[model samples]
Target chain A: MLPMSDLGRALCIITGASRGFGRTIAKEFSRVVRPGSAFVLVARSGGDLRSLQAELTETEAGRAGLQIRCVEADLGLAEGLERVTKAAQEVATDLTEHVLLVNNAGSLGDISRFTKSFTDMTEVNSYLSVNVSSFLCLTAQILQAFPQRPGLRRTVINISSLCAVKPFSSWVLYCSGKAARDMVFRVLAAEEPDLRVLNYAPGPLDTDMQLEARSKSGDVQLRKSFSEMFSQGQLLSCEESCVKLMKLLMEDSFTSGAHVDFYDI
Target chain B: MLPMSDLGRALCIITGASRGFGRTIAKEFSRVVRPGSAFVLVARSGGDLRSLQAELTETEAGRAGLQIRCVEADLGLAEGLERVTKAAQEVATDLTEHVLLVNNAGSLGDISRFTKSFTDMTEVNSYLSVNVSSFLCLTAQILQAFPQRPGLRRTVINISSLCAVKPFSSWVLYCSGKAARDMVFRVLAAEEPDLRVLNYAPGPLDTDMQLEARSKSGDVQLRKSFSEMFSQGQLLSCEESCVKLMKLLMEDSFTSGAHVDFYDI
Candidate 1:
């Protein structure tokens, strides 16, 4: 993914900025957007977001149009959303025009049940609240916060998963959470046809989350299979995935109605 | 559909029994399921449930082994879930072994966008609460409730729509709600391999809901298209779809994992 920003002077608020793909997207934003551009980094860990803020702020390319601010919030609760909202409001100058909402924070629930196990319940609730409810609220608030700015475009990129379309065994909560999240975007798009909403299915990526998933799976055979898959280089790099996402963000031909695959676009 | 005692002596719970598919399913259960068997009917309206209960209990087949119990409660909130849980506890009898949970209640949110309208918020929040959260809680509770009495076979039939797989243009809330519900069942199947879960896409059905949807779509061209589709026999009768569903329930070879299409099975 080349570093170029056509989204000039736009304020981008990315959740899950502490690590994984969100971090990569934020970095890309820093590289592409011009100097004096503002970014609001949201995550559960304040220290991690602050570190990334400092890192992005220190780069020569980052200094071009980048101003970083970090906000710590669970992003899964109402209070968390309020905090993010408050921070976005406080840094009002960066958010004058279009708002880019990237709902990237999510969890893969305990993958071991047809029955409702305790682990499954907690994981399912947390995932739904974080991945679906949080996205819905944040998107609604942003739309309300910044009504359509003339000559400026607003877009929502919901970082969905390939598991949404594929029936991967043991990824029940994760899969459903994603599917639900996709539906939210679909519904929102249908309601506001003009809104640029993308349910971005980025496929698989070689990330720490996958490693953590493989380890916590508990099933030895399943862990071995995942390890084999990961080792076979079937996963996308964070940069590769982010590049595709950036391309989609730049493309004007695609509308806000479909579940788009990164490779297809 | 022909009214057979396929369920025999098993216990079943059907929500949204005040009217529509919920009422039909409860009646069908009463017609089948041998004498002395339990069928707990849940709905929001008590008067309607009492009348339905009287009709079911009066049947000769009902006299054999069918014990119809009506529990009035809205399956749309935490209080509703608590009500249903209490009802489930009450319905548990010495003969109650296995349980078949049918999560069939559905709603169509405000058909019009009506931006900033209270209707939209009510429709969105209510639909989310009922069509997703309540159903999920129901699945969770039933799964947890059935673990007792070992060797008890449990089945969760999530009645989905064709729109779940194929995106619809205007029925934003209805289509997305069903889509999310279907994904919940998929997640359940993935999480619990032992449970028999089916996301039964009942295709387009000639139900009141469909008629209401066709009328309130606010597009003349779309209504005509929908009518043409139905007239062309694209829609199936409830009896036919229900029979297909019952067949899936009775069949032993249809292994469960994720979403199972009625057409495919």
Candidate 2:
């Protein structure tokens, strides 16, 4: 089991760190890791990453000597993946006792249509290129960047969803992407018994994604439910979900590669 | 439930139908369907497709009045998918009472390496293009081509594996692809209640895939197990596994979108 205190000296890399849950995690996770910890924040938006970098540097962990690197690149593209992996490698220092990578980058594909409407090969391929293929390859690249060594604990967190286990109508791309990612990391856990992998499904959070779901989902009933959840204040805040995730991480008792939901913890 | 004796007057399309389990399915299914039934066999190997077409043409169903069209194309490429869907659209005649689409085309991606070794985006994208993306898009296209209508039962059979539910060491691409495809079809079952979707895991079969697994799989234990299965003749022949699948279809008692294994039946 992990020690009774906050995580010490972790080399944390969070994708999609510019906005939403990724940004919230960056701020909240900073408060947990000790001084001398490093963060590699990656996203496509340069301005947002810069602002996040500034906000993180002013925090307690940052003032105590946290090193923050903002990587403005698309996690979906090969070149963008190269930049992030290279940044993480460069930031992996001798003080890095634990490695925690948050694979949070994803897109809710055109939910305005049903499964049968996704006939164009280019459209489908582009979706998988971003969500499935890139996610798998990026995790592989990051793990490669930080090889296993004595006293160096490695943990991979996938910001997964309920869709990973449940099938949602008109959510073919997002659900399949989540499902594939969960299985990919499960394979990672099976192969590397020493590594810790968690597929954390942050509950339906009140975020831009939820708004998109409410407005654009193809199934009218599903769309209305999202709107109702918002109106009823049933949606979780990013911090609310992240707190549960933090508790799970501190407990460190989850079966490696388990699909743990916010409510499950 | 589907009729007990035989499936009559259907437009049957099978991918990867040139050899292995797919070929067995084509031949076995030919025996069960009535006259005026059409068969669309798709494979990258034109010669193999031609030979299978010829073989299928000599069968009793063929002799009676079965129409066979060979699509020499790769399921991985857009052009190949276009060709198959076009051919299926052309073959959906007035006599076509039922449409059965067998999504059997897939590749066992580079299994000689671990998850951490698959860092190249191109390699990963190419693998997904064939296994994951193409499978989803093709299904959507076929469904679009043959819209749901009165008296026209639509059946989609995904040649899934235990890997769909169980992750294997170093079999990242194949396992995840299967998982994603199963979930994709599950969504299809949810969205289209009238459509029949079955994910059939054919156990371990004595086919070219097994040979490849025994020779090329990275994990020593996994490779040895495959070898042991082969040496002990524990692997089911293609015909044997297909017989179980045939039984499942003929009975048609399975819940739509269920992952029914050969042993389960």
Candidate 3:
């Protein structure tokens, strides 16, 4: 296999593509990949997706023959997974030498409560259904829909976080979910050595999630820390973090199953 | 504070106590704690729990006034959790200067397929509902049921595995579940300094789980390695592993929320 410099005519499928780091991924990835590469943007907001799609279609790559499909669906349900994978399969064979599945959709869970306060089974299960279960299931479904074949490179990027490796007070659910997803992809990388799996931690970006963290975290000290980060201008923009992620993909030198952080790079 | 030698007049609650590692924990803990310590054994099999309770009444600890309560409950269901926590509260007041909660119930998800083959959302959700979601919810419920007081010392033991830190092929569900549970406890420890949290990895023990792993693991090499461990008499007995866990608690020297393995000690 030759060293690849770009995501060659690929079918790139991204969850949470309507906002935040995922939106940045859609914009950055579109510019670097080949002309025939297709994009499947998935999210819960259909209006946001259509607007993003419209914006992408207006780009130079859009006029140069790039295909973009907006999938409006909630990633927390089975029906949502089916809709996205079906769309991915539809555009999979069109000038596609590479397949990219970005498992980026996730939830903040209920950070308004401490770990000890999270005793409700239904609530906990509901959180895992989206953050943990759906993420793993969607990845597997997309991989099955687009199987390994000659001249095709399959890459999976699990949008991981520092929370996955370190424990944060009052953020137990989020930490647990991220850790589980990262391990799932790690096992996938181990099982399929040919696959490119990278657990990318996109720093503490100035996204809506940061807004939630700074305003409403259950732990006082943690909430203060996040607020201080925002006030001190220490948070990275979505585009800034996405650039580092794209660099990792372009170089393709990262060890499979490894967690790569934007700050680390 | 004095150095503790035993679980002094404590209320000990253990899940999956009908057999295997959980059963060993019940036996070893009953023998070592103070005379007034109460034991609440929880499992799916009411019959097994009754027999174990009857056998316990024959022991010196039982005869010397150690209270024993059997709760027939599945840790996977919400109702099951409610039953166990209620029973725990009942026995909690008597002989309960210290509180010990052992989270020992878990399931080995289907190892008949590789990670890529796990595409069904419902199947994955069911597995997680039992192993990951229920485990965290149960711990949180127990802690909430028995709020920390000045006179009571609280300790939680999460029965983790080597799989929690290391990924194994065809064992994505088990790995992800264990990894998630460990991070949950780690966060709990960070949030509550008064709580004693131990993520104890009881090596590759000789149990029913090993039997299933040796026979059904989808990865041929991993299955053969487990079989080889069994044939060479290298697997630790449940009693042996339980003894190490007891020592960890008695010595009380491990870092809070740290993952300690049988081999490491």
Model 1 C-alpha lDDT per residue in residues A153-262, reported as the tens digit of each score = 67888888876766555565666667767876776676666678888887667888888767776446667777888989877788898887877776545668578886
RMSD of 3: 1.1
Model 3 residue-pair collision total = 0
Name model 3 segments beyond 4 Å from true. Answer: A1-3
**What is the lDDT for B214 in model 3?**
97
| Interface Cα RMSD, each model | 4.4, 0.8, 0.6
Report how far off residue A91 is in candidate 1 (Å). 5.4
The lDDT of each candidate is 0.70, 0.90, 0.90
* RMSD over all Cα atoms, model 2: 1.1
Docking class of 2: high
Candidate 3: tens digits of C-alpha lDDT, residues A1-265: 4455777998999999999989999999998888788999999999989999989999988989788999999888999999999998887764589999998888898898999888888998888999988899899988888887888889999999999999999999999999999899889999999899999999999999999998989999999999999999999999999888988888888999999989899
Candidate 2 C-alpha lDDT tens digits along A82-199: 9988989898888799899999989999999999988877887888888878888888888888888988889999999999999999999999888999999899899988899999
